[model samples]
Target: MNALLQQLQDKQLIWLANQTEAPYEHCQSTGFPALDQLLGGGWPQHNVVELQSHGACAELQLISKALNHSGSELLQVWINPPAHLCAEYLLQQKRPLHQLIQLNTHRAADALWAAELCLKSGCCIDVLLWQNSLQLTQLKRLQLAAAQGQSQLYLFRPLQTGQQLLPWTLSLQLMPASTGLQIRILKRKGGWQQQDLLLPWAELYPQFIKPELQQRHSSYPPLSRVS
Candidate 1:
């Protein structure tokens, strides 16, 4: 039994809770120092990461760095995005515009179908799916497809559904903040749930974090770049 357990550990199939092990080999960097540290190096490859947000809260900006790092050869597919992605913004972020693919599936069923097809195609580096509703069975199917194709999937959902923990490799909740974005780690493969982490964005993206008129009685100061 000891030898078998040792072999499984060597093969990366099993891990001890106390062992300092990375989630998976060759994890992708999120480009946020605090987030990267929280995710045990970076986002695990070939796994689904569920990102939940109430409304427009800089969620795309959170993963823009990882998408930019994805090579130009393999495609970065987006299915049922909240809105039409701006080409100029992609260019501004240094993303490979030529490798980007967007699919507008009006129906929920069609959106899932399109997402599954893209994830199982093996030609895509990563797939972004904006879906408000999903089931445990659907998530499991997508997870298997992702592993088969060796691609990553980012499923965007409404904040309400984030309360029920599912089988996603990782899950995060994004909330708008006065300074930047508040990130909560809802679920992680080898990590415990954590408190809200405020990531100040003025230093990283000045254009996104605008200066607003400060309210005298407000709890926090207006968000602005210190420099």
Candidate 2:
């Protein structure tokens, strides 16, 4: 044990104590192996993942996958999902409704506050903030709160502009592919490789399919949104 500690100290002297054998918490997966491969094993428990997309549906699918993957296990998921933002679709994903903390805040500032409060608590491991109407101050405050909590954050913002400015551990911009969607890792940390990967729609939701089923769906859903 001493030797192991000594080696870890030598390799990660600055973070040795913090990283020392603390039960190896599994990261929350986005339910796509290809995308999970892009973001190391999965999205780290204590980091921010930026989902900069042009539309709302893409971000919704990604966030739902993460929530379903974690699902009453190692971490709980809290989402500031306003009423106008398609809550029925989220429930239709078939994840546990009870485990989800659904907040109904219309104002962007209120939503940001709820998100920050959820993050600050160590109880919640993952949070998804749907920010289609957030201002500059709201974004900065959310960023600061996320940083302070040291918890995993998924910020979904609709940015139809040229590009996005990323300030998180991982930045993913997903585009429409011929059949499915193309996910690109615009920013990353650690040993993550592969800037771009093709993630099929079928791959994102494996639970909906029967485990013993051999056939695969032939048609892809109509391309309604891209980010």
Clashes of each: 0, 2
User: lDDT by residue for model 2 over 37-153, one digit each (tens)?
Assistant: 666667666656677676633556766666665535434544655445445665686655566666677676777777878777766656877677545465566666656765667
CA error at residue 30 for candidate 2, angstroms: 3.3
Per-residue lDDT value at 24 in model 1 = 70
Q: For each candidate, what TM-score against the reference? A: 0.80, 0.62
Q: What's the C-alpha lDDT at position 17 in model 1?
A: 74
- State candidate 2's TM-score: 0.62
lDDT of 1 by residue, 1-227 (tens): 99999999899898567764555766888888888887877788898998999767778878888888876789999998877789998889877787888988769989888888888999998899989888998999899889988888999988864367586678888887877788888878767666678887664466744545333344686677455
> What do the candidate models score in CA lDDT, each in turn?
0.82, 0.63
Q: Which ten residues in a row have the lowest lDDT in candidate 1?
A: 209-218
Error of 2 at 218 (Å): 11
Cα-lDDT of candidate 1: 0.82
